[model samples]
Target chain A: MHEYSVVRSLLRQVQEIARSNGGGAIETIRLAIGEFSGVECTLVELAFRDLAPEKIGRQAKLEIQNIPLEAKCENCQQNIIITNYQFCCPRCNSQQVRITAGDELTIIDIELREVGVNA
Target chain B: MNQTITVNRDLKADLKEQANRFRQRMSDQGTLVVNLVSSPGAGKTSLLQRTATKIGDEYRLAVLVGDLATDRDAERLKPYVPVQQLTTGGACHLEIPLVESGYERLNQSDLDILFIENVGNLVCPASHDLGEYLRVTLLSVTEGDDKPGKYPKMFRTSQAMVITKSDLLPYVPFDVSSAVEDARRIQPELDFLTTSSQTLAGVDEWCEFLVRQLRKIQK
Candidate 1:
């Protein structure tokens, strides 16, 4: 699947952020992938488990957070969270809506152990 | 000791920012780059072949085709217009870096249009922008009518959808209207055209739409 490539980009971004923050050995990689983003989660986890680079993040744990698809109801004037791929407003039953979230693929944070600090 | 750092980074946003820069450069030169996506054997190449023939006299058209192997698509389109192929080795989708390199290889000036036939995929390519001003996603009639609802990401992001192989509608159970309606539900503003390159069914209307869009963008 394309999750392998997505993981490569994620790993590259994680390395850059880790490098800026003292270049320590990483322990955890926190990420957020949206439901509407078209990325399969299980495949991403599989890729991370197999492909996380040894030098920078051999022991890093992958934590992927799911972001539900949320839309702004123009008629209801409120934010409605969608669970079943429906874009209609849950409260007002209006079809006119704009997506607010659940289309993001971002690395939120990381936890790292300083080189030789624990051992 | 473990240090927790809250460094939020939007990776797709970063790629899109770069894609926007590439798109802007093409816009500056009055060229429209359209990223075409579809499942394999969904008539992307045939549609382009028809498009090149119908409008080849009116515009200087060139195509860059991406596939995992072989320059076959490029060769297929060579009889019509300028063609370049980007062999991705094994990647499912063509990303910005490969697209940038392919664009350089085309090496034309003042061209009226450029078409990028993305690696034959409906899912992964939905995430990669490739610096296109417009995206046209194709769903062949044989692929079934409910694909739009099943795979909404491609339909959601695409500005237009082509129901290809309309000639097979007589033999297949694909409900053209239902497919169009499904796509419209995902993208209310999406334009739909039913086409069969074999019969030249809707090629003119498709080409006309492209010309209209090109004119609108140029003005």
Candidate 2:
């Protein structure tokens, strides 16, 4: 799956950040993966486990947040919560609308063990 | 003591930061980045070969080809100018950081056009932002006309659509006009182009359009 590539980028970014922060080793990587982002969490975890250790983030723990899709109806301007990809107006059944949220894959922050502070 | 918790937030801020940095870098270097999306066997490589031959010397062109494995595309594109094949290593899509790195690897030169051939998938590739000036999605004549309507995101996100393998149009059931019309219904400003690598039909127009966009970025 594409999860392997996503993890590779995730690992690269996390390691860069960690390396930038005085070359400290990273212990955690937090990711916000939205439901509509089309990425499965279990697969991401599996990818991280397989790929992360080979890079600069050899011992990092992965943290993933699943975001739900949200959209607003164009006709009635109703804010509707969605679990899937369809963005339809509940009031008028209008398909003309925009996605408000839920499609995101990013590393928000990382936990690190300060250099020379730990064995 | 240890505890468990949930961290949640949409990456609005993160994406914004990435976008800002990307826009600044692209604008500073006058780089016209085009992310080419399509299904496997949609003739993206063939189209690139034709395009590079048409306008290779006139512009500072480079390509970042993505695939599950191999440097074959890069090797093929070498004689033209510069080509970097990014092996996704079993990944389906290219992300922003990788593109940024690819830019650096290209020596941050004054590129008139940078073609990023994304992994051949019509769905998820449309969702991720690769920081392109224009997004072009391709559908070959053999892939059926219903693809535009079926995968609305790819059509909606792209600024243009290319129907490749037009040489086979006579034998195929593809209705080029209807497919273009369908894409326009979903995205009003989406431009459509058709080409056949074998016959070299419509290839000039495609190169001209790309050259025009690259020139616009330069100005």
Best by DockQ: 1
Candidate 2 deviant stretches above 4 angstroms = A4-35, A40-70, A73-96, A105-119, B1-6, B10-20, B184-186
Angstrom error of the Cα, residue B52, model 1: value is: 0.6
Q: Quick one: how many clashes does candidate 1 have?
A: 0
Candidate 1 ranges beyond 4 A from true positions: A53-57
Residue pairs in candidate 2 whose N, alpha carbon or C atoms collide under 3 angstroms: A2-B92
lDDT of 1 by residue, A5-88 (tens): 788888888788778888888889889999988788999999888889653546788999999998898897898897666666
lDDT per residue for candidate 1 within B1-219, as digits (tens), equals: 888889777867767887999899988889989999999999999999999999999898999899999998999999998988999999999888888888888898677788999998888898888999899998999999999888788888899999999899999999988888888777777899989999999999999989987986688
Clashes of each: 0, 1
Worst 10 residues of 1 chain B by lDDT: B7-16
lDDT of 2 at B109: 79
Give the TM-score of chain A, superposed on the true chain A, for all candidates in the order listed. 0.90, 0.88
Question: How well does candidate 2 score on lDDT at residue B181?
Answer: 76
